[model samples]
Target: MRLSDYTRLLALAAIWGASFLFMRITVPEFGAINSAFLRVFFGFVGLAVILLALRCPIRFNGKFRACFTLGMINSGVPFVMYCIAAQWLPAGYSAVLNATTPLMGALIGFTFFAEKLTLSKWAAVILGAVGIAIITTFGEAHSMQELVFGGLACLVATSCYAVSGFLTRQWINNQGGLDPKIVAFGSQIGATTLLLPLFIFTSTTDTSIHWAQGEVWASIIALGVICTACAYIVFFRLISDIGPLRSMTVTFLIPPFAILWGYVVLDEAISQGFIFGSLIVAVAVWLIVRPAKQAEEVKALQS
Candidate 1:
């Protein structure tokens, strides 16, 4: 990768990693559903502006429904889940758990999509589970129940992400593929639509929402515009320039940034157990996602 590509990759990871911190900041004031709704709503608006600026065709070629439904699963549900976790888990904990998406993807693909799972993948799945258990057991939380629930919420979010990946391939990529930017824009629309009624209900019923707080609104704007909208543009560009495999290295980079931001900004404690669990999860993710040809080359060298 060129220096520009590397720079973009780092920027994307930083943006995404900070999303957890943003949620942690906003969810207390906005509530989980409200925070999620505003995120996709503003994300939709941000992407629309980008589309207009670039004069990109808004055509979905009759795939708007698919794109929209995928958005609900990909963005809407997962965003809510993470927001819920933000109430209990530290931002760094949530980010480290988010790294399990690839492990969940491997398992989901094997079970539901008929994708092959090799021996290494099986080990990865086991190790990932172990890492999660360690984090939950040893990491700080308000209570045992809250810790378990928060951890489960993170897993649910990652599972949604895993499912959406396969669904995207089937619905969009296989069907002559829409522009990635359009797909992203459509998905945010779907997410916003899905959360609209819930947002309304919460807005009316929850009188405690801190609507006038500048910091809360600022976090929401950054989460939606920079983290969701701009990150997508950079990610798609990285895929185009360096291909998906290399671009995916951003996943490995995100947790460190998340941890750094949490410690530096939120003053969240970094326990030894958190560090050890994160390392294990990182190894497991590498096992699951390392390219087959690269693995084969390493094996040959060892032999």
Candidate 2:
């Protein structure tokens, strides 16, 4: 990979890593559904502005359904899942779980996309499973019940991301690749549509809403504009430059930054189980990422 690509990867990891911090800050004040709605809603606004400035046609480029599906699975579902998780898990905990994306991606490839699973990948999966076990069983957290539910939510969210990665290669990249702005904008639009009613219902019913707090508002804008919108653009560029397989390496780098942010911003302490589990998950991602030489071939398999 080129130095610039490496820089983009690290930068993407940092932004996404901080998403956990932002969510942790905002979700409690606004509640999960409302917070997630704000995220996609603002993400749509940010991407729309970028699309206008770039003069990229906001209209679909022959793949409307695909873009919408990608958004619903990738952004809509996962955002809500993570928001719910943020209610219980610390930022670093959720970030480490995010590293499971490649593991889930590899599993999806092997099962549905006819990709070969090397022995290393099998070992990686086992290691990842073991890492998750250690984290869930032994990690430092307040409540075991909350930890279990939070961990499960994070897993489901990453699985959605893994599916979206494959779908992006199939539905978008193979069709000569949509402009990154279009994909980002369309996805956020789809997410916003899915979230709007939920946001409204929660706003009406949830008495805990704290729309007036400065921290709450700041985290909301940062989560949507910077983390979701800008991160998507950067991620799509990395996929264009380095292919999706290599683009996924960002997951491995996210946890440290997340742990750092948690420690500094939230005063969350790191435990040995968290450290060990995180290392194992990183190894699993590295192993899965190593053999993905052709992303399109793996993602778009014929029956």
Candidate 3:
């Protein structure tokens, strides 16, 4: 990989890592649906402005169907689930569970998408599962109930991400490669539309809605512009340059930043179990990320 590609990967990691912090800040005040809705809405506006500034004309055909599917699986459903899960799970724990996205993506690709899985990939899945088990079992000594539920939510969210990634790769290849900005815009717009009604109903209670807090606005703005808009751009660019599996390395780094934000900003307790579990998860991801023949074949097809 080129230095520039690595730089983009790092930037993607930072943006996604910070998403946890922003969600933590805003979700409790705004409610999950409203928080997710505003985030996608702002992100759509930001990307739309960028596209207009660049004078880039998007070729939007009947791809609205595919785009909506991607948004539902990628952003809409997963974002809400993750935020809901975070309400019960620690931010750090939620993030660590999210690190399983790549593994989930790989497995889904191998099964449904016909991207063959080698022994190495299977081994990675095993290791990743073990890591998840350790984190769930040891991370909470008193009650595993909430943690288990959170972990399951995270897994479902990760699976959603995996499906999204495969679909995106297909989209890009079919279009002879597209501008990342356009893809980002389409997904954001789709998510905003899909989530609108839910936001109105779920966040109706006055006590649940805190639209006045400056922190809430700050979190919204940061998540919209930085995490959603810019992060998606960086992510697509990274995948285009380095391939999807390699681009997924960002997941391993996101947890540390999430943990840091939780500790420094929220003053959340830093438990040894959190540290140990995080390490195990990271190692498991590394095992899965090692180059696989099937992934290599998929990359070749893309090229």
How much is 102 displaced in model 2, in angstroms? 0.6
**Tens digit of lDDT per residue, candidate 2, span 80-198?**
99999999888999999988988988888789877678778899999999888878776776788888889999999988888888788888898888878788888888888898888
TM-score of each candidate structure, all chains considered together: 0.92, 0.94, 0.91
lDDT, candidates in the order shown: 0.86, 0.86, 0.79
Error of 2 at 66 (Å): 1.2
Candidate 1 per-residue lDDT over residues 30-66, each given as its tens digit: 9999999999998999999999999998999999999
By TM-score, is 2 or 3 better?
2
Screening candidate 2 with a backbone cut-off below 3 angstroms (N, C-alpha, C), the clashing residue pairs are none
Question: Cα RMSDs of all predictions?
Answer: 3.3, 3.0, 2.9
TM-score of 1: 0.92
Off by over 4 Å in 1: 1-8, 236-249, 294-303
How much lDDT does candidate 3 score? 0.79
Greater-lDDT candidate between 1 and 3: 1
